[model samples]
Target: MMEMILKTKQVSEELGVNPSTIQRWVKFFNLPCQRNEHGHYLFNEKHIEELRKIKDQLSEGLAMTDVQIDIPKKEAVKTKEFTLNNEIEKRLDKLIMRIDNMERRLETKADEVVSAQLLQHRLEIDDLVKKINSLENTLLEMQEKQTFQMQDYHSDFMLEKPKPVKRSWFASLLQLFSMIKS
Candidate 1:
Protein backbone atom coordinates (compact mmCIF):
# COMPACT_ATOMS: atom_id res chain seq x y z
CA MET A 1 0.00 0.00 0.00
CA MET A 2 2.89 2.40 0.76
CA GLU A 3 4.57 1.62 -2.60
CA MET A 4 1.47 2.82 -4.58
CA ILE A 5 0.11 6.41 -4.68
CA LEU A 6 -2.49 8.53 -6.60
CA LYS A 7 -2.58 12.26 -7.01
CA THR A 8 -5.67 14.35 -6.21
CA LYS A 9 -6.17 15.19 -9.88
CA GLN A 10 -6.03 11.53 -10.91
CA VAL A 11 -8.47 10.59 -8.17
CA SER A 12 -10.88 13.37 -9.10
CA GLU A 13 -10.77 12.28 -12.79
CA GLU A 14 -11.55 8.68 -11.90
CA LEU A 15 -14.34 9.77 -9.58
CA GLY A 16 -15.83 12.15 -12.20
CA VAL A 17 -15.62 15.17 -9.89
CA ASN A 18 -13.52 18.27 -9.33
CA PRO A 19 -10.32 18.01 -7.32
CA SER A 20 -11.72 20.57 -4.87
CA THR A 21 -14.70 18.33 -4.25
CA ILE A 22 -12.49 15.43 -3.40
CA GLN A 23 -10.39 17.70 -1.21
CA ARG A 24 -13.52 18.86 0.65
CA TRP A 25 -14.60 15.26 1.14
CA VAL A 26 -11.17 14.29 2.39
CA LYS A 27 -11.07 17.20 4.85
CA PHE A 28 -14.68 17.07 6.08
CA PHE A 29 -15.01 13.29 6.15
CA ASN A 30 -11.67 12.89 7.99
CA LEU A 31 -10.60 10.30 5.42
CA PRO A 32 -7.54 8.28 6.55
CA CYS A 33 -4.48 9.65 4.70
CA GLN A 34 -0.79 10.39 4.84
CA ARG A 35 1.07 13.52 3.56
CA ASN A 36 4.37 13.40 1.73
CA GLU A 37 7.33 15.71 2.57
CA HIS A 38 5.64 18.35 0.33
CA GLY A 39 2.42 18.16 2.43
CA HIS A 40 0.45 16.58 -0.47
CA TYR A 41 -1.96 13.69 0.02
CA LEU A 42 -0.62 10.30 -1.16
CA PHE A 43 -3.29 7.68 -1.79
CA ASN A 44 -2.63 3.94 -2.40
CA GLU A 45 -4.01 2.34 -5.57
CA LYS A 46 -5.98 -0.19 -3.50
CA HIS A 47 -7.59 2.66 -1.56
CA ILE A 48 -8.76 4.37 -4.78
CA GLU A 49 -9.95 1.02 -6.10
CA GLU A 50 -12.03 0.52 -2.96
CA LEU A 51 -13.48 4.06 -3.29
CA ARG A 52 -14.44 3.26 -6.88
CA LYS A 53 -16.36 0.19 -5.69
CA ILE A 54 -18.15 2.30 -3.09
CA LYS A 55 -19.01 4.96 -5.72
CA ASP A 56 -20.32 2.24 -8.07
CA GLN A 57 -22.42 0.80 -5.28
CA LEU A 58 -23.85 4.25 -4.61
CA SER A 59 -24.55 4.75 -8.29
CA GLU A 60 -26.62 1.53 -8.12
CA GLY A 61 -28.95 3.31 -5.66
CA LEU A 62 -27.32 2.19 -2.45
CA ALA A 63 -26.97 4.70 0.42
CA MET A 64 -23.70 4.61 2.33
CA THR A 65 -24.06 5.90 5.93
CA ASP A 66 -27.21 7.76 4.79
CA VAL A 67 -25.19 9.85 2.28
CA GLN A 68 -27.19 10.35 -0.93
CA ILE A 69 -25.39 10.01 -4.31
CA ASP A 70 -27.25 12.80 -6.07
CA ILE A 71 -25.27 15.30 -8.18
CA PRO A 72 -24.61 18.70 -6.67
CA LYS A 73 -27.75 20.84 -6.71
CA LYS A 74 -25.95 24.07 -7.78
CA GLU A 75 -24.36 22.43 -10.83
CA ALA A 76 -27.66 20.96 -11.98
CA VAL A 77 -29.36 24.34 -11.66
CA LYS A 78 -26.62 26.08 -13.62
CA THR A 79 -26.88 23.44 -16.37
CA LYS A 80 -30.64 23.95 -16.63
CA GLU A 81 -30.20 27.71 -16.77
CA PHE A 82 -27.62 27.39 -19.57
CA THR A 83 -29.94 25.18 -21.57
CA LEU A 84 -32.84 27.61 -21.18
CA ASN A 85 -30.72 30.57 -22.32
CA ASN A 86 -29.54 28.70 -25.42
CA GLU A 87 -33.07 27.71 -26.33
CA ILE A 88 -34.34 31.29 -25.91
CA GLU A 89 -31.52 32.67 -28.02
CA LYS A 90 -32.25 30.22 -30.84
CA ARG A 91 -35.95 31.09 -30.86
CA LEU A 92 -35.24 34.81 -30.82
CA ASP A 93 -32.91 34.48 -33.81
CA LYS A 94 -35.54 32.60 -35.75
CA LEU A 95 -38.18 35.19 -34.93
CA ILE A 96 -35.98 38.06 -36.08
CA MET A 97 -35.22 36.27 -39.35
CA ARG A 98 -38.91 35.68 -39.97
CA ILE A 99 -39.70 39.36 -39.39
CA ASP A 100 -36.98 40.41 -41.80
CA ASN A 101 -38.32 38.08 -44.46
CA MET A 102 -41.81 39.45 -43.98
CA GLU A 103 -40.56 43.00 -44.32
CA ARG A 104 -38.81 42.11 -47.58
CA ARG A 105 -41.95 40.49 -48.91
CA LEU A 106 -44.01 43.55 -48.04
CA GLU A 107 -41.60 45.77 -49.89
CA THR A 108 -41.78 43.57 -52.94
CA LYS A 109 -45.58 43.64 -52.87
CA ALA A 110 -45.60 47.44 -52.61
CA ASP A 111 -43.29 47.72 -55.59
CA GLU A 112 -45.52 45.44 -57.59
CA VAL A 113 -48.57 47.50 -56.72
CA VAL A 114 -46.86 50.72 -57.73
CA SER A 115 -45.72 49.21 -61.02
CA ALA A 116 -49.23 48.05 -61.80
CA GLN A 117 -50.68 51.51 -61.15
CA LEU A 118 -48.08 53.10 -63.39
CA LEU A 119 -48.86 50.66 -66.18
CA GLN A 120 -52.57 51.39 -65.87
CA HIS A 121 -51.97 55.13 -66.03
CA ARG A 122 -49.79 54.75 -69.13
CA LEU A 123 -52.48 52.74 -70.87
CA GLU A 124 -55.10 55.42 -70.14
CA ILE A 125 -52.83 58.14 -71.56
CA ASP A 126 -52.24 56.16 -74.74
CA ASP A 127 -55.99 55.63 -75.20
CA LEU A 128 -56.68 59.34 -74.76
CA VAL A 129 -54.00 60.25 -77.32
CA LYS A 130 -55.50 57.83 -79.87
CA LYS A 131 -59.01 59.28 -79.34
CA ILE A 132 -57.70 62.82 -79.82
CA ASN A 133 -55.99 61.87 -83.08
CA SER A 134 -59.19 60.30 -84.41
CA LEU A 135 -61.19 63.44 -83.57
CA GLU A 136 -58.61 65.67 -85.24
CA ASN A 137 -58.78 63.62 -88.47
CA THR A 138 -62.58 63.86 -88.51
CA LEU A 139 -62.46 67.67 -88.06
CA LEU A 140 -59.94 68.05 -90.90
CA GLU A 141 -62.07 66.02 -93.30
CA MET A 142 -65.18 68.14 -92.46
CA GLN A 143 -63.27 71.37 -93.14
CA GLU A 144 -62.00 70.09 -96.51
CA LYS A 145 -65.53 69.19 -97.64
CA GLN A 146 -66.81 72.67 -96.69
CA THR A 147 -64.02 74.33 -98.74
CA PHE A 148 -64.83 72.22 -101.84
CA GLN A 149 -68.58 73.04 -101.56
CA MET A 150 -67.77 76.77 -101.42
CA GLN A 151 -65.58 76.54 -104.58
CA ASP A 152 -68.33 74.68 -106.51
CA TYR A 153 -70.89 77.36 -105.52
CA HIS A 154 -68.56 80.11 -106.81
CA SER A 155 -68.07 78.35 -110.16
CA ASP A 156 -71.87 77.93 -110.62
CA PHE A 157 -72.52 81.60 -109.72
CA MET A 158 -69.92 82.77 -112.33
CA LEU A 159 -71.57 80.65 -115.11
CA GLU A 160 -75.04 82.12 -114.36
CA LYS A 161 -73.83 85.80 -114.44
CA PRO A 162 -74.47 87.74 -117.82
CA LYS A 163 -71.60 89.54 -119.62
CA PRO A 164 -71.52 93.34 -119.54
CA VAL A 165 -73.27 94.82 -122.78
CA LYS A 166 -71.67 97.63 -124.86
CA ARG A 167 -73.55 100.61 -123.44
CA SER A 168 -73.07 104.26 -122.39
CA TRP A 169 -70.82 104.76 -119.33
CA PHE A 170 -73.70 106.58 -117.59
CA ALA A 171 -75.99 103.56 -118.21
CA SER A 172 -73.35 101.04 -116.83
CA LEU A 173 -72.86 103.23 -113.75
CA LEU A 174 -76.64 103.29 -113.17
CA GLN A 175 -76.84 99.43 -113.47
CA LEU A 176 -73.93 98.97 -110.97
CA PHE A 177 -75.70 101.31 -108.50
CA SER A 178 -78.94 99.30 -108.88
CA MET A 179 -77.12 95.96 -108.28
CA ILE A 180 -75.40 97.34 -105.12
CA LYS A 181 -78.82 98.51 -103.73
CA SER A 182 -80.39 95.03 -104.40
Candidate 2:
Protein backbone atom coordinates (compact mmCIF):
# COMPACT_ATOMS: atom_id res chain seq x y z
CA MET A 1 0.00 0.00 0.00
CA MET A 2 1.11 3.49 -0.76
CA GLU A 3 1.79 5.66 2.27
CA MET A 4 -0.01 8.99 2.47
CA ILE A 5 1.85 12.16 3.29
CA LEU A 6 0.16 15.39 4.28
CA LYS A 7 1.41 18.91 3.81
CA THR A 8 1.74 21.40 6.67
CA LYS A 9 -1.44 23.22 5.75
CA GLN A 10 -3.39 19.99 5.60
CA VAL A 11 -2.04 18.84 8.94
CA SER A 12 -2.91 22.16 10.56
CA GLU A 13 -6.43 21.98 9.25
CA GLU A 14 -6.75 18.42 10.41
CA LEU A 15 -5.58 19.29 13.90
CA GLY A 16 -7.69 22.47 14.05
CA VAL A 17 -4.55 24.46 14.75
CA ASN A 18 -3.25 27.52 12.99
CA PRO A 19 -0.57 26.80 10.39
CA SER A 20 1.91 29.07 12.07
CA THR A 21 1.21 27.46 15.41
CA ILE A 22 1.84 24.08 13.89
CA GLN A 23 5.10 25.34 12.43
CA ARG A 24 6.07 26.67 15.85
CA TRP A 25 5.20 23.36 17.45
CA VAL A 26 7.34 21.54 14.94
CA LYS A 27 10.22 23.90 15.63
CA PHE A 28 10.00 23.94 19.42
CA PHE A 29 9.14 20.29 19.84
CA ASN A 30 11.71 19.07 17.34
CA LEU A 31 9.19 16.82 15.66
CA PRO A 32 10.86 14.35 13.33
CA CYS A 33 9.39 14.99 9.92
CA GLN A 34 10.37 14.95 6.31
CA ARG A 35 10.97 18.16 4.43
CA ASN A 36 10.73 18.81 0.78
CA GLU A 37 13.66 20.26 -1.11
CA HIS A 38 12.04 23.66 -0.61
CA GLY A 39 12.06 22.98 3.15
CA HIS A 40 8.30 22.52 3.43
CA TYR A 41 7.21 19.89 5.93
CA LEU A 42 5.91 16.60 4.56
CA PHE A 43 4.02 14.85 7.29
CA ASN A 44 2.84 11.30 7.64
CA GLU A 45 -0.15 10.10 9.66
CA LYS A 46 2.09 9.49 12.64
CA HIS A 47 2.99 13.15 12.74
CA ILE A 48 -0.66 14.08 12.73
CA GLU A 49 -1.31 11.76 15.69
CA GLU A 50 1.63 13.22 17.55
CA LEU A 51 0.48 16.76 16.89
CA ARG A 52 -3.00 15.89 18.04
CA LYS A 53 -1.63 14.51 21.28
CA ILE A 54 0.48 17.59 21.76
CA LYS A 55 -2.53 19.79 21.17
CA ASP A 56 -4.57 17.84 23.69
CA GLN A 57 -1.79 18.10 26.24
CA LEU A 58 -1.44 21.81 25.78
CA SER A 59 -5.18 22.25 26.04
CA GLU A 60 -5.10 20.39 29.35
CA GLY A 61 -2.67 22.94 30.84
CA LEU A 62 0.53 21.06 30.12
CA ALA A 63 3.47 23.34 29.58
CA MET A 64 4.89 23.56 26.08
CA THR A 65 8.37 23.07 27.43
CA ASP A 66 7.25 20.08 29.49
CA VAL A 67 5.61 18.22 26.65
CA GLN A 68 7.84 15.83 24.74
CA ILE A 69 7.37 14.39 21.28
CA ASP A 70 8.15 10.78 20.37
CA ILE A 71 8.27 10.30 16.67
CA PRO A 72 8.89 6.78 15.45
CA LYS A 73 12.08 6.13 13.58
CA LYS A 74 11.47 5.72 9.88
CA GLU A 75 13.26 6.25 6.65
CA ALA A 76 12.76 9.73 5.29
CA VAL A 77 10.97 10.37 2.04
CA LYS A 78 13.28 11.29 -0.82
CA THR A 79 11.41 13.79 -2.94
CA LYS A 80 14.03 15.84 -4.70
CA GLU A 81 13.34 19.19 -6.36
CA PHE A 82 13.72 17.85 -9.87
CA THR A 83 11.35 14.99 -9.16
CA LEU A 84 8.71 17.36 -7.83
CA ASN A 85 9.18 19.67 -10.79
CA ASN A 86 8.85 16.82 -13.25
CA GLU A 87 5.68 15.52 -11.60
CA ILE A 88 4.10 18.97 -11.57
CA GLU A 89 5.08 19.55 -15.17
CA LYS A 90 3.60 16.24 -16.19
CA ARG A 91 0.32 17.01 -14.45
CA LEU A 92 0.18 20.44 -16.04
CA ASP A 93 0.85 18.96 -19.45
CA LYS A 94 -2.01 16.48 -18.96
CA LEU A 95 -4.31 19.29 -17.89
CA ILE A 96 -3.40 21.29 -20.98
CA MET A 97 -3.97 18.30 -23.18
CA ARG A 98 -7.38 17.75 -21.63
CA ILE A 99 -8.20 21.42 -22.17
CA ASP A 100 -7.15 21.19 -25.78
CA ASN A 101 -9.33 18.13 -26.31
CA MET A 102 -12.26 19.87 -24.64
CA GLU A 103 -11.74 22.92 -26.83
CA ARG A 104 -11.74 20.82 -29.94
CA ARG A 105 -14.94 19.05 -28.87
CA LEU A 106 -16.61 22.33 -27.88
CA GLU A 107 -15.81 23.92 -31.24
CA THR A 108 -18.24 21.52 -32.94
CA LYS A 109 -21.09 22.12 -30.44
CA ALA A 110 -22.12 25.58 -31.68
CA ASP A 111 -23.25 26.51 -28.15
CA GLU A 112 -22.38 30.05 -27.07
CA VAL A 113 -22.90 29.32 -23.37
CA VAL A 114 -20.58 26.34 -23.42
CA SER A 115 -17.99 28.33 -25.36
CA ALA A 116 -18.07 31.13 -22.76
CA GLN A 117 -17.74 28.61 -19.95
CA LEU A 118 -14.75 27.04 -21.66
CA LEU A 119 -13.23 30.49 -21.99
CA GLN A 120 -13.67 31.09 -18.28
CA HIS A 121 -12.11 27.74 -17.43
CA ARG A 122 -9.25 28.50 -19.79
CA LEU A 123 -8.67 31.78 -17.98
CA GLU A 124 -8.59 29.92 -14.67
CA ILE A 125 -6.06 27.48 -16.09
CA ASP A 126 -3.97 30.40 -17.29
CA ASP A 127 -3.99 31.76 -13.76
CA LEU A 128 -2.76 28.39 -12.55
CA VAL A 129 -0.02 28.49 -15.17
CA LYS A 130 1.07 31.88 -13.92
CA LYS A 131 1.16 30.63 -10.35
CA ILE A 132 3.21 27.62 -11.42
CA ASN A 133 5.63 29.95 -13.19
CA SER A 134 5.98 32.04 -10.05
CA LEU A 135 6.66 28.92 -7.99
CA GLU A 136 9.27 27.75 -10.50
CA ASN A 137 10.95 31.16 -10.30
CA THR A 138 10.99 30.93 -6.54
CA LEU A 139 12.62 27.48 -6.72
CA LEU A 140 15.23 28.82 -9.13
CA GLU A 141 15.98 31.73 -6.80
CA MET A 142 16.35 29.34 -3.86
CA GLN A 143 18.72 27.12 -5.83
CA GLU A 144 20.80 30.18 -6.76
CA LYS A 145 20.98 31.28 -3.13
CA GLN A 146 22.11 27.80 -2.04
CA THR A 147 24.77 27.76 -4.74
CA PHE A 148 26.13 31.15 -3.67
CA GLN A 149 26.12 30.14 -0.01
CA MET A 150 28.10 27.01 -0.86
CA GLN A 151 30.53 29.06 -2.91
CA ASP A 152 30.98 31.46 0.00
CA TYR A 153 31.52 28.58 2.41
CA HIS A 154 34.15 26.99 0.18
CA SER A 155 35.94 30.30 -0.36
CA ASP A 156 35.99 30.99 3.36
CA PHE A 157 36.99 27.53 4.58
CA MET A 158 38.93 25.79 1.80
CA LEU A 159 42.69 25.32 2.33
CA GLU A 160 45.41 26.05 -0.17
CA LYS A 161 48.72 24.21 -0.70
CA PRO A 162 51.72 26.02 0.77
CA LYS A 163 54.44 27.09 -1.67
CA PRO A 164 57.83 25.35 -1.43
CA VAL A 165 60.67 27.55 -0.18
CA LYS A 166 63.35 28.46 -2.73
CA ARG A 167 66.94 27.74 -1.55
CA SER A 168 70.26 29.02 -2.90
CA TRP A 169 72.99 26.56 -4.06
CA PHE A 170 75.19 27.46 -1.03
CA ALA A 171 72.44 26.69 1.41
CA SER A 172 71.65 23.37 -0.34
CA LEU A 173 75.39 22.35 -0.23
CA LEU A 174 75.67 23.22 3.48
CA GLN A 175 72.50 21.18 4.30
CA LEU A 176 73.89 18.20 2.29
CA PHE A 177 77.27 18.36 4.16
CA SER A 178 75.51 18.57 7.54
CA MET A 179 73.38 15.50 6.66
CA ILE A 180 76.50 13.64 5.41
CA LYS A 181 78.27 14.36 8.74
CA SER A 182 75.27 13.14 10.70
Candidate 3:
Protein backbone atom coordinates (compact mmCIF):
# COMPACT_ATOMS: atom_id res chain seq x y z
CA MET A 1 0.00 0.00 0.00
CA MET A 2 1.42 3.41 -1.01
CA GLU A 3 1.51 5.88 1.83
CA MET A 4 -0.98 8.71 1.16
CA ILE A 5 0.40 11.99 2.48
CA LEU A 6 -0.54 15.48 1.18
CA LYS A 7 -1.07 18.90 2.75
CA THR A 8 -3.82 21.47 1.92
CA LYS A 9 -1.20 23.94 0.66
CA GLN A 10 0.38 21.37 -1.67
CA VAL A 11 -2.97 20.63 -3.30
CA SER A 12 -3.89 24.30 -3.50
CA GLU A 13 -0.61 25.14 -5.28
CA GLU A 14 -1.10 22.24 -7.67
CA LEU A 15 -4.63 23.29 -8.49
CA GLY A 16 -3.71 27.00 -8.80
CA VAL A 17 -6.45 27.85 -6.22
CA ASN A 18 -6.13 29.18 -2.72
CA PRO A 19 -6.14 26.58 0.13
CA SER A 20 -9.30 28.22 1.52
CA THR A 21 -11.21 27.35 -1.70
CA ILE A 22 -10.29 23.67 -1.37
CA GLN A 23 -11.21 23.72 2.30
CA ARG A 24 -14.57 25.28 1.49
CA TRP A 25 -15.25 22.64 -1.17
CA VAL A 26 -14.34 19.90 1.26
CA LYS A 27 -16.75 21.30 3.83
CA PHE A 28 -19.51 21.91 1.29
CA PHE A 29 -19.42 18.72 -0.84
CA ASN A 30 -18.49 16.47 2.14
CA LEU A 31 -15.63 14.76 0.33
CA PRO A 32 -14.05 11.76 2.03
CA CYS A 33 -11.38 13.11 4.39
CA GLN A 34 -9.83 12.20 7.75
CA ARG A 35 -8.46 14.26 10.61
CA ASN A 36 -5.21 13.25 12.23
CA GLU A 37 -4.61 13.11 16.01
CA HIS A 38 -3.44 16.77 15.68
CA GLY A 39 -6.83 17.60 14.08
CA HIS A 40 -5.26 18.28 10.65
CA TYR A 41 -7.17 17.09 7.56
CA LEU A 42 -5.78 14.15 5.56
CA PHE A 43 -7.21 13.36 2.09
CA ASN A 44 -6.66 9.99 0.44
CA GLU A 45 -4.71 9.70 -2.84
CA LYS A 46 -7.87 8.92 -4.85
CA HIS A 47 -9.55 12.10 -3.60
CA ILE A 48 -6.45 14.08 -4.48
CA GLU A 49 -6.46 12.56 -7.98
CA GLU A 50 -10.12 13.47 -8.45
CA LEU A 51 -9.48 17.05 -7.34
CA ARG A 52 -6.56 17.33 -9.75
CA LYS A 53 -8.75 16.21 -12.67
CA ILE A 54 -11.44 18.74 -11.74
CA LYS A 55 -8.83 21.52 -11.51
CA ASP A 56 -7.41 20.57 -14.92
CA GLN A 57 -10.81 20.69 -16.56
CA LEU A 58 -11.66 24.04 -14.99
CA SER A 59 -8.37 25.61 -16.06
CA GLU A 60 -9.13 24.46 -19.62
CA GLY A 61 -12.08 26.92 -19.60
CA LEU A 62 -15.16 24.85 -18.75
CA ALA A 63 -18.45 26.63 -18.22
CA MET A 64 -19.19 27.63 -14.63
CA THR A 65 -22.33 25.46 -14.45
CA ASP A 66 -20.33 22.28 -14.98
CA VAL A 67 -17.93 22.96 -12.10
CA GLN A 68 -18.59 22.72 -8.37
CA ILE A 69 -17.63 25.69 -6.23
CA ASP A 70 -18.70 27.28 -2.94
CA ILE A 71 -19.27 30.70 -4.41
CA PRO A 72 -18.31 31.96 -7.86
CA LYS A 73 -16.94 35.43 -8.53
CA LYS A 74 -18.71 37.54 -11.10
CA GLU A 75 -17.19 37.55 -14.60
CA ALA A 76 -14.83 40.52 -14.97
CA VAL A 77 -16.52 43.41 -16.69
CA LYS A 78 -14.65 44.71 -19.71
CA THR A 79 -13.58 48.34 -19.22
CA LYS A 80 -15.92 50.11 -21.70
CA GLU A 81 -18.63 52.70 -21.14
CA PHE A 82 -20.43 53.28 -24.46
CA THR A 83 -20.92 49.66 -25.56
CA LEU A 84 -22.26 48.46 -22.22
CA ASN A 85 -24.72 51.34 -21.76
CA ASN A 86 -25.80 51.18 -25.41
CA GLU A 87 -26.48 47.46 -25.16
CA ILE A 88 -28.61 47.89 -22.04
CA GLU A 89 -30.49 50.83 -23.56
CA LYS A 90 -31.20 48.93 -26.74
CA ARG A 91 -32.61 45.96 -24.85
CA LEU A 92 -34.77 48.21 -22.67
CA ASP A 93 -36.12 50.08 -25.70
CA LYS A 94 -37.03 46.83 -27.41
CA LEU A 95 -38.88 45.63 -24.31
CA ILE A 96 -40.82 48.89 -24.05
CA MET A 97 -41.73 48.85 -27.74
CA ARG A 98 -42.95 45.28 -27.45
CA ILE A 99 -45.14 46.17 -24.46
CA ASP A 100 -46.59 49.19 -26.28
CA ASN A 101 -47.43 47.07 -29.31
CA MET A 102 -49.16 44.50 -27.12
CA GLU A 103 -51.20 47.22 -25.42
CA ARG A 104 -52.27 48.62 -28.80
CA ARG A 105 -53.35 45.16 -29.91
CA LEU A 106 -55.39 44.73 -26.73
CA GLU A 107 -57.09 48.07 -27.27
CA THR A 108 -57.96 47.11 -30.83
CA LYS A 109 -59.42 43.83 -29.62
CA ALA A 110 -61.54 45.62 -27.02
CA ASP A 111 -62.87 48.03 -29.64
CA GLU A 112 -63.81 45.12 -31.88
CA VAL A 113 -65.77 43.56 -29.02
CA VAL A 114 -67.67 46.82 -28.45
CA SER A 115 -68.41 47.14 -32.17
CA ALA A 116 -69.72 43.59 -32.27
CA GLN A 117 -71.99 44.28 -29.29
CA LEU A 118 -73.35 47.43 -30.96
CA LEU A 119 -74.04 45.50 -34.15
CA GLN A 120 -75.88 42.84 -32.16
CA HIS A 121 -77.97 45.47 -30.42
CA ARG A 122 -78.89 47.04 -33.77
CA LEU A 123 -80.00 43.67 -35.09
CA GLU A 124 -82.23 43.15 -32.02
CA ILE A 125 -83.75 46.60 -32.47
CA ASP A 126 -84.49 45.86 -36.15
CA ASP A 127 -86.21 42.62 -35.15
CA LEU A 128 -88.29 44.47 -32.55
CA VAL A 129 -89.33 47.04 -35.19
CA LYS A 130 -90.46 44.27 -37.53
CA LYS A 131 -92.57 42.73 -34.73
CA ILE A 132 -94.12 46.11 -33.92
CA ASN A 133 -95.04 46.70 -37.59
CA SER A 134 -96.72 43.27 -37.77
CA LEU A 135 -98.68 43.99 -34.54
CA GLU A 136 -99.84 47.37 -35.89
CA ASN A 137 -101.22 45.71 -39.05
CA THR A 138 -103.10 43.18 -36.89
CA LEU A 139 -104.53 45.94 -34.67
CA LEU A 140 -105.82 47.86 -37.77
CA GLU A 141 -107.67 44.79 -39.10
CA MET A 142 -109.26 44.07 -35.68
CA GLN A 143 -110.33 47.72 -35.26
CA GLU A 144 -112.10 47.66 -38.67
CA LYS A 145 -114.10 44.55 -37.66
CA GLN A 146 -114.91 46.03 -34.25
CA THR A 147 -116.37 49.17 -35.94
CA PHE A 148 -118.57 47.02 -38.24
CA GLN A 149 -119.97 45.08 -35.27
CA MET A 150 -120.66 48.27 -33.33
CA GLN A 151 -122.67 49.66 -36.29
CA ASP A 152 -124.65 46.35 -36.69
CA TYR A 153 -125.81 46.20 -33.03
CA HIS A 154 -128.79 48.34 -31.80
CA SER A 155 -127.64 51.20 -29.59
CA ASP A 156 -130.54 50.50 -27.11
CA PHE A 157 -129.09 47.00 -26.47
CA MET A 158 -126.03 48.64 -25.01
CA LEU A 159 -127.90 51.55 -23.22
CA GLU A 160 -127.00 52.39 -19.62
CA LYS A 161 -129.64 51.32 -16.94
CA PRO A 162 -132.38 54.00 -16.33
CA LYS A 163 -132.18 55.96 -13.07
CA PRO A 164 -134.91 55.17 -10.34
CA VAL A 165 -137.88 57.63 -10.27
CA LYS A 166 -137.66 60.38 -7.60
CA ARG A 167 -140.78 61.80 -5.69
CA SER A 168 -141.37 65.58 -5.74
CA TRP A 169 -140.30 67.66 -2.70
CA PHE A 170 -144.06 68.37 -1.83
CA ALA A 171 -144.92 64.62 -1.77
CA SER A 172 -141.89 63.90 0.44
CA LEU A 173 -143.06 66.65 2.94
CA LEU A 174 -146.72 65.23 2.99
CA GLN A 175 -145.37 61.71 3.68
CA LEU A 176 -143.23 63.00 6.54
CA PHE A 177 -146.34 64.87 8.09
CA SER A 178 -148.48 61.69 7.79
CA MET A 179 -145.88 59.65 9.62
CA ILE A 180 -145.78 62.30 12.39
CA LYS A 181 -149.68 62.27 12.85
CA SER A 182 -149.74 58.47 12.99
Worst lDDT window (10 residues) for model 1? 68-77
Cα deviation in Å at residue 123, candidate 2?
Answer: 55
lDDT of 1 by residue, 1-182 (tens): 34768888888898997777566445433456677888777677655764566567767885443343233454223345444554665688899999999999999999999999999999999999999999999999999999999999999998896877789999989999999999
Tally clashes: model 1: 0
Candidate 1, after superposition: displacement of residue 5 in Å? Answer: 46
CA lDDT of each prediction against the hidden true structure: 0.71, 0.81, 0.71
The C-alpha local distance difference test score for the whole of candidate 3 amounts to 0.71
Question: Candidates ranked by TM-score, best first?
Answer: 2, 3, 1
State how far residue 4 of model 1 sits from its true place (Å).
Answer: 48
TM-score, one value per model: 0.38, 0.38, 0.38
**Model 1 score (lDDT):** 0.71
